[model samples]
Target: MTQLSSNQFIRNLTIQDIDDCIILESKGFPPEQRCSPENCRYRLSVASNICLGLFETTPLGDSKLIGHILATKIATERITEAGMGKRIQGVENSGHFENSRNIGIHSVVIDPEYRGVHLGHIFLTKYIEYIRQLKLADKILIINKESLIPFYSKVGFENLGLTDCRFAGLIDYDMVYNL
Candidate 1:
């Protein structure tokens, strides 16, 4: 239950949120770094329960998307292009897992207008708690660039050093948070 205001809250992101998410993706990531529309659709269609959206509801009853996180289950600690890039065969489509102890965080995007206020920190904290509550995995994993290492570290993800996988022409480091 993370909130920016009384009217702002978090919920599972669904297919209905694709357009809003795509817009936010563009604002949050470079052209080569953003997730594709097809991938977004598939993730939402198959695992929306594991994805989350932050929204603000106005007095007029209008709801606006503010930010979101995309994730999937992984069977191993091995980071691969299939999991981060290919999208289809890389991660599990199930919202939760029985044997897999890893949850692969695909993307996290906060609206530029909402950044600089530590909203990403708050949102990620809440997401971690939510997943823990669901018993989704024994640990969570993320592949992020060097510039983002400190940010993810602040949220408790331990850096596992540089990985061989390349995303959008940029090398990423492996990070983990044990449940």
Candidate 2:
């Protein structure tokens, strides 16, 4: 695999990226924490643009996806609604992706080999900029590992305390970044 560099570019994900994304997701997260393939496909099919990918150019003029951030938009009110609220546990099942004012950041993963280079920060910064440019949502929320609270804080996300939803059966915190 080609090493990622500063020349890396961020772009909207495409259908062709699903498989690679699933592979990376598997590698980056534990089985229970992994989003199902069906859900991954659903996100790509419905909200491809908001699903962002980080790619680096290869020596042979190809590009390889090294990281990705998947998110969906949902209304604040619907977040507390019955079935719709439960779907917030993961973006794939969220019924409000078609039209909503809040952006739920479902998952973010980087190639294990590329972990220490700050790619997560770079990807999130660009994603936030993109969201701001579109003005699609007033806030962005994420359920993440408690250990990562500091990491997300650096990106302007404020911790809202532990979430009721247990993704992968792990204790997770809900954090939000107001746009």
Candidate 3:
């Protein structure tokens, strides 16, 4: 794990992390909203370096993944020209991960037991830092619930109003953070 503190750290997701990530995904979102295991595996195979997990170190030298944020890179032009509405589909379906200038945050989840501790914020901050360090993308985008607009805004994402694509029967808003 990439140490963030004495007891906490963030690191890239690995093949071994898929099961844990799926569990967290199930707990965090409904079935229709969660990415399938195949998709998660595909993401890891393609861009494992960008898929991050936040963990707390145990006294016994073990660690638990308490939160995670996964992303896929997409061409900035596609988003700017085609618009986010047209590309809200699955990243694996888009075939845009190869060479891109923007990152789409597919999911972000924190363990229920770990909420309210700003762990989500901490994970996101560190994720952004990692992105910058790697020069990964020119910007980051996310389609999130309206309730999360302010939260994302606080993280430097600008609201782009409602999105055209609907997933899991919930209305979502598009937000972007330019690097």
Candidate 4:
């Protein structure tokens, strides 16, 4: 795998990244598990939390977004933003952690063509740092596939427990990280 240099640009996503973000998500996951356009838009517009995108400058000097990390408030605030869909409360157990105002890491996706690069880690590290800056959350909750456990573990996440989840009829596990 190639490592990203410290200078790589990872920042808050903007409206211009919508198509790239959606395309990257589709590359990483099935259609049913991907965030809808409206959800991505909401993440981009949320006040206290944010979604991030990874971009690399091309040889010609233009930059292209190739990865994203999506996060949102974990409690009643999430209820207001999401308006009752799957209600990830099961995966988001940290929502009530006294010292930590939880942030649900709803998705992380990289462009398939960019898979062998460490942009995913870069994206997560930046996202976590951003969350810490707000000091609103010291913990992050993730709902993910069992197969990705090793990857998340390497990034400081642990298996909080199992959850009865369904996505295109497939099951998943709930993972957490106390940042």
Q: Estimate, for each residue in 1-179, the C-alpha lDDT of model 1 and write its tens digit.
A: 23566877999998999999899899999999898897788778767878899898978999988889987676568555666533444455423333567888888989998788788998999999999999977888989999999999999999999987687888889999988
Over the stretch 20-127, how does candidate 2's per-residue lDDT look in tens digits? 999989989988777678777867777787889998888898988899987666655222222123345655544445667787777799999878878888789878
For all candidates in order, the CA lDDT equals 0.82, 0.77, 0.77, 0.67
Displacement of residue 15 (Cα, Å) in model 3 is: 1.8
lDDT of residue 13 for candidate 4: 81
TM-score of candidate 4 against the unseen true structure? 0.78
The candidate 4 region of ten consecutive residues with least summed lDDT is 76-85
Q: Residue 142: error of model 1 in Å? A: 0.7
What are the models' TM-scores?
0.89, 0.86, 0.86, 0.78
Best by TM-score: 1
Model 2, residue 55: distance off in Å is: 0.4
Model 2 TM = 0.86
- Cα misplacement distance, residue 137 of candidate 2 (Å): 1.0
Better of 3 and 4 by TM-score: 3
Candidate 4 lDDT tens digits, 1-179: 34566445777787767778777778888888887876676666662236777887888888888788876656632222232133355564332223336667777888888776676776687677777787777567777788988888888888865645453555677787776
Candidate 1 has what TM-score?
A: 0.89
